[model samples]
Target chain A: MIELSPILVTLKLATITTLILLLIGTPLAWWLSNTSSKSKVVIESIVALPLVLPPTVLGFYLLLALSPDGFIGHLWFYISDTPLSFSFSGLVIGSVIYSMPFVVQPLQASFDMVGKPLQQAANTLGANSFDTFKNIVLPLSKRGFLVAITLGFAHTIGEFGVVLMIGGNIPEVTQVLSIIIYDHVEVLEYTQAHYYSIGLLVFSFIVLLVTYSFNRKLMVRL
Target chain B: MIEVNYKYKLNNFLLDVSFTMPENGITVLFGPSGSGKTSVLNLMSGLGNDKNKENNSKFILNDRVIDDSVNGLKLEPWFRNIAYVFQDHRLFPHMTTSQNILFGFNRCHSELKPEVLIEKFKIKELLGHYPEQLSGGQKQRVSMVRALLSQPDLLILDEPLASLDYTSRQELLPFIECIHKELDIPMIYVSHDIKEVLRLADYIIIMDKGKIVDQGDIADLCISQPLLTQQEGASFILDARVTKIIEEDKLVELDCGETILITAESMRLNDKIRVLIHARDVSLCLSPPQDSSILNCVPICIDEIQTDENGKLRVIAKIGEQTIVSLISHRSARQLNINKGKQMYAQFKATAMIK
Candidate 1:
């Protein structure tokens, strides 16, 4: 029988990583879309580095940054007395870095598509910037949010190299589906690997299918 | 009074404009495209960040200094209480018509009720419908109601009727007039269309290449500014009062200095109206013709005569204190022997448009 602990850990990591990305990526994406500052390009390039850079490159830096003696790890150790290098929380940080572009690019594009005319109209009608974004921009970017959430969750589930480097094969903790599949292949258990791989494939396809169909209905209404 | 002084540097143009408008009635910002007409409206409403902060711009509306770069005072648009009606009718697509109208009314402490504006603009039936479900005319009507219900100190209309067809524009003009008449809120309307300007403007500020070329009362500016009269080679406005209405002929007799008959069916007796007479429509005669088909033949004394371009003579005259301009070819001027101080009859078919 297939061990279900790895599958559960993967789902939990993906869920937690997506929640953090949405919380931070929203304001970052809004700033990227609306700001005319000179540093916009620098911020945009850093956010998009995950899409082009190899996962091992990001994982290597994250490993150093989350070590007990490193800046972030020292703070975490002082606060919780738990090492962050190989913990579940460390895997979350690595996954967020690896999936930054997946969440931000779509949100930024949607915010840009909302345009400035409607915002100006809202302002002249006595709505402030925050109010305009909440009422006008957020409602109009529903499809973009759907695409971003689906891509972020799917990208986190499919992570392999970053998870291997940062989350070292701790059963029921950080041994996600991809890492467990790698373990099965190393031990020459092709049947176990096939079970997890097929599961992921079906899950991703169903998620994307639902999102695209729902997005089409939204476009019709718009 | 609304006093504005702004200087902004665009990509390839520099806009420098300063003028004061009346505290009441419609003040029109008239110019061609790229003339910075919309820029003035944007700066006044604080809708766009096009103001050059370093260049010392000052915007004072009824003694409140809304923007003064020298003092580092620029209020945010929401705090300024200015309403804008854009050309595209920027209603919220996610909200229904009623929600869009109340988006402003609910946000501000407004005394004007939404029901009154809804009934006036005739958008009550469209309340439950989305913006996309309404026609272009209906959408514009809803936007106007939305702007009015905000209880803005001043309303800025940036060519609100520009996107509609001629028939829809004609249908919507009466509602715009009612905003000025019933609500009595000051409005700054921007348009390049001369017909729209003549129909609505109480004060006119003519702009060209981002500068104020001329500005005055519409009656005075129509005779002094050639741009206002270029469509008909020179026209004049007569502010008259309706003295009699002949229901059988669908005509109304107006008295300026003398009684003038115009084809108007809706005007009641004793109503004040303004008649725009194209200079080309008026003909000069040595005496009033007895059997002419023209309905108006008022005696006017020639005050001045100037040669216009293309061998045309613009004959400026007066009927009491009201000014009338007539454009005739040099040949006709010589044939009629018209000169300064000559007492002549100006005959034309007049059309009265209610102000």
Candidate 2:
């Protein structure tokens, strides 16, 4: 029988990573869409680096960065007195970094589509910056948020290289569905590997189908 | 008074303009396209700024200094309490017409009721509909009501009717007039169409190449400026009151410093109107014609005579205190012996453009 701990841990990591990325990516996407500053290109290139860079390259850096003697892990040691490597928190950090562009790019495109004319109209109507963003920008970017949440959650669940390098594969903690499938394939247990792999494939298909249908309904109403 | 002085450098030209408008009437920024008319509106509303130029501009509305470069005082657009109606009718697509109209009212802290403006603009039926569901004219009307309900200290309309069909424009003019008549707020309207300018403007500021060419009362400016009269060669406007209507002849008698007869229908007595007569249509006769098909023959004294560009003589004359222009060839002036202080009968077929 397949253990359920890896499935639960995978869902929890995907959920937590998506939530954290949403909070961090919103303002960053808004700034990218509206700013004319010179550093805009620099910020955009950095955000998109994960899409083109090799997964092993990113995993190597994350491994060094989260070790007990490294920069982030040294800071965490002073606060939590627990090492970051092989911990669930380490896996979450890895997933968030690997899945950032999935959340930010769609949001930036949607914000750009809204454009500046509507915002200026809102400002002349006595809505300040924050008020305009909430009432005008947020409501108009509903499709962007939906796409970002789906892509970010799915990307984290399928993470392999970054989670392997940093999570250290501890059962009931850092060992997730993808890592369990990898272990079964390595031991020549083809039947067990098929179980988790098929489940993920069907889950991803249903999620995308639901999202597209919901987006179509929204388009008709708008 | 609304005083404005702004200087900015565009990519191809420089805009240096300064003018003051009255505090109670429609002051039209009239000019051709690319003349910086929209830039003036944008600067006053604080919707845009020129970063390449020096920041020594001054904008004051009704004794409140909203922008002063020397004092470093620049208020944000929301704090300025100025409403703007754009040419495209930029309503929020996500909100219904009622919600869009109330977007400003809820934030402005003003006591003006949305129901009153909704009824006045005749947009009550559209309250439940989205912007895309409304027609172009309906969208513009909703935008106007949205701007009005804000209770702004000033309103800026940037060619609000430029994008509509002729019938829709005709339908929207009455609502604009009602706003001027009901609300006491000052407005700066921009338009390149001469008919819109003549019908709506009480004061006019003509611009050319980002500079103020001329400005004054609409009646005085329309007659004196060649730019305004270039299209038809020296047209003049007469502010007249209807004294009598002859229904059988389809004519109306107007007292424009003299009894002037015009071919018109559906006019009531004691109604005020404006008559626009082209100078080329007027012919001067030394004696009043005893039997002529032309009806209007008012006796006017020549005030001045100037040579026009195309070998024509423009005769500036007066019927009582009202000014009239007659464009005649130099040979006709010589034949009629028309000089300053000479008395003659000016005859034309006057068209009544009722305001």
Candidate 3:
């Protein structure tokens, strides 16, 4: 039998979190960059809250929220007669929130840099708002989107406390690489922890190096 | 008709302006810097406005009252049917020239095709090139063409040539002249250069200190002594007929009521030309001098004299039915003892005359 390893679990969580962040964070980033509301500070603070808050704190909130009697969990229970707590889906939700900033900040900065003239010119040329975004905004922000997805996927792979708090190290379902490493260290499995730590360190370093190198190359070309 | 009235205050630079123009021909917003020329264009285009106000400013097109504060009427920039040629000529950096031009025309119903305009504006060679590859003049030309392709009712240009070099400015002038002649859309051309205004503007609006100081025909400003007295750099344009050309001497004689000889390139024998003679180019002599290269000497009576903005006296002279504007040093005025009713010879260069 194949040992459903920590590496496989980490990969699954990263992929799921990256996909969810892409779907949800893109519109949020676009709105944050374009809208001129007075509540911009509040909205920005909320999106960026995960960056400063401890992962355990965020996870604790999610754990409470996803329990059977908790607000979101009760709604889920009413819909499906089961809470998302201790489930793979709960871990995915926690990872998505934890990695949202990695997906959104790059996109916001890129959208802001693109300026209004191109969009204004397109509008005067009779393209509606949606058409303008599709043709102009999306194409121009292609590099930013690439950076966002890469950072988000890599960021979710490193999550520890958030996944542990919500998913509770359930084998085959919630025991990701971070939890496996924590379990190894707690049981004094020094060799396995060292191997997993080196693997994660190398993987994260490669992802970040690629991001910086690609960003520098793009800046020079642009 | 097109009418605009708006007031905006930003960081203590208050811009209060109002103007009305017919819905055809070019109406130039001629002014010096800090005169709020571009601010007026922005107001018309609905680009820059304080968010606090509802932007009740009115812009009327063809008497439809496109914007009216009292009636709570306002149209979005797309529906307003106004096209702006910015000074920087903000072409999309990512698109080719053809794509940029076509983007606007794809929405326009006008019979003016992109191919025809590209050929007419001589941007055919630049169709596949990106905007960064084009020179400043080429970009401005494309900008005008792009705005035209949008088929706007009002074409607004905000100092489009001010950023280009002299040669590029010269290269772009003919295309602007072509558009001025070929198109029926009303244009609001903004420029600080007096020469450009004289060349293209049919109706001139002189802006100063955020106010419409004067608005009239260029000919009227050229002939008015009171207006000339107020101008810091007053010059005159003459409606002259080329009576004869001395091909032997490479000189053309223009009959500006009296004969004014100008050294110019070859032209038709009897072509009517408009000559611009700067006030600084003219000197006063009590009597016509001999053996001087100043060939365009005309005997004239000083009709009026007044001190201008720089505290220098400008003398208005009348030779036959035509008036000539001259600027002389205050000491020269005293040294020559020049005043109204004094007859003096106006000596200036023939080359200074621009046809």
Candidate 4:
């Protein structure tokens, strides 16, 4: 039988991960766009690492880091007195790393595309750095933000290998839609797997359809 | 007075210069391409100083310190209250003309009315349109209004007309002149165009090879530095007032030291203007000739004569209090017996270049 908890958990995880990515990713993306430091290439490569690295390899490191005695889990245990492994917070951390490039790359490209000339022009006209970025840069980078948000949310929803490695398969806690599909296929429950699979397919298509149609309007305005 | 001193080093080019400009009127920063004119303006405005923190630079305007590297006191660009009009007219693409002009004015607490500049720059009808919808000249005009509404203490124009076509440039010059005539704001105008320098400059600063070469008043420098008149090799400037207009002949009479007539249109009486006369155009004669086709001749006494390296002699003379120069060959100088204190008539065609 089909269950509702996996879909709800998947949506919740994707929403929280996307929100966290945007919070940290904006300044990181902006720095990568404008910085000329020699370390820029190194940081960029690290951010882009997830695109090529297998999810199992990334999950292995994350699992070790989130264990009761590991670096991240030790800190959380000191604060909350609870183990981080097999917890929703730990799933969030893993998803943030897995979805980072999807959010940051688009934002960086958009920031670079905004260029320096208009920013300099704004500076001459008595707009401070923050004021210029808020009024000029942010408004011009609308398409970038849209793409980053959509990709970040969708990629987190589709993640399977990393969740399986760290989530401990705890239903209504760490079990997400993709992990449930894997569990169903393993037990030969083809009907249940087909439902969630087709659901995600339609949902991703609708999200992209809304974004691209909105993008066309923005292009005409420009 | 405004003082600027910078020991700037960029790549292989090093520019170490110190100079003071008058606190009022337009000071033209004239130089050839790649002579660091724009760099100097950027320093004065406190922009593009990111990589040059180690170098010493100081900019003081009217006794207020704007930038002092020694003290580590550098005012940011937004706090400087110095508006800049770039050659490309960098108006924000996302903004309408009204919003772009208001960007600066709203940020600062200034009493300058935007409507006055709007009407003066003729951008009232264009306020609703975005910059992309406007023509090149129209975009430049809107940008000028945008800068002026800020009510800057000093304005910097970096070849504001350089990007426009001939007709657009001609159309924009009068608006720039209108700004000079109406506003008392001191301006630093940068250009490689000499005609622009002659028309707008109250003081001139010339730069070459990342250093200031010569600096003076426009009329004085035109004679003292012959190379400034790059096209004709030598020229002179006359500040004259229109005394009469002969509409039938399509001529306007100008009273400098001597009254001269030139074919001009849309001139009004008592209108003050600058006239540029090429040294090669003026001919010397022992006396004024009535049978000659030239319609303008003025009596003058030669003050100085020098032979240039081009095997040509340049004669400097005075018309009332103003200076005029004539370029002639050694053969012609000897033939006419031209020398200092020699009284003679200077004859030239009526169609001298007048601005």
| DockQ in order | 0.89, 0.87, 0.50, 0.85
Query: Among these predicted structures, which one has the highest TM-score?
Result: 1
Compute the TM-score of each model's chain A versus the native chain A and list the values: 0.98, 0.98, 0.93, 0.98
Q: Which stretches of candidate 3 lie over 4 Å from their true place?
A: A1-8, A190-199, B9-14, B32-35, B63-65, B119-125, B165-167, B198-200, B222-233, B240-273, B285-295, B309-311, B319-322, B330-337, B342-347, B352-355
With a 3 Å backbone cut-off (N, CA, C), the pairs that clash in candidate 4 are none
Taking the candidates one at a time, how many backbone clashes does each contain? Answer: 0, 0, 0, 0
For A1-222, candidate 1 gives per-residue lDDT tens digits of 699899899999999999999999999999999899899999999999988888999888888889998888899999999999999999999999899899999999999999999999999999999999999999999999999999999999999989998899999999999998899999999999999999999999999999999999999887
Task: Please write out the lDDT profile of model 4 over residues A1-222, one tens digit for every residue.
Answer: 789998899999999999999999999999999998999999999999999999999999999999988999999999999999999999999999999999999999999999987898899889999999999999999989999999999999989889988887899999899988888999999999999999999999999999999989998887
* RMSD, every candidate, angstroms: 1.8, 2.8, 3.5, 2.6
Clashing pairs in 3: none
Judging by DockQ against the true structure, name the best candidate: 1
lDDT of 3 by residue, A109-211 (tens): 8898787877777766667778888888887887898899898998888888798789987788888887888888999988888888888899999988998
Off by over 4 Å in 1: B265-269
Error of 3 at A58 (Å): 0.8
lDDT of each model, Cα atoms only? Answer: 0.90, 0.89, 0.82, 0.89
Candidate 2 structure quality by residue, lDDT tens digits, B1-355: 7899988776678888899999987999999999999988888888766575566689999999988888988888888889999999999999999999999898899889888889999999999999999999999999999999899999999999999999999999989888987888898999998878877888999999989999998889877777776554356788899999999988999999989898888878898877777778888999989999888899999999987777788898998899998899888988988889999999997564555
**Candidate 4 lDDT by residue in tens digits, B10-30:** 555887768899988889998
- The full ranking of all candidates by TM-score, starting with the best, is 1, 4, 2, 3
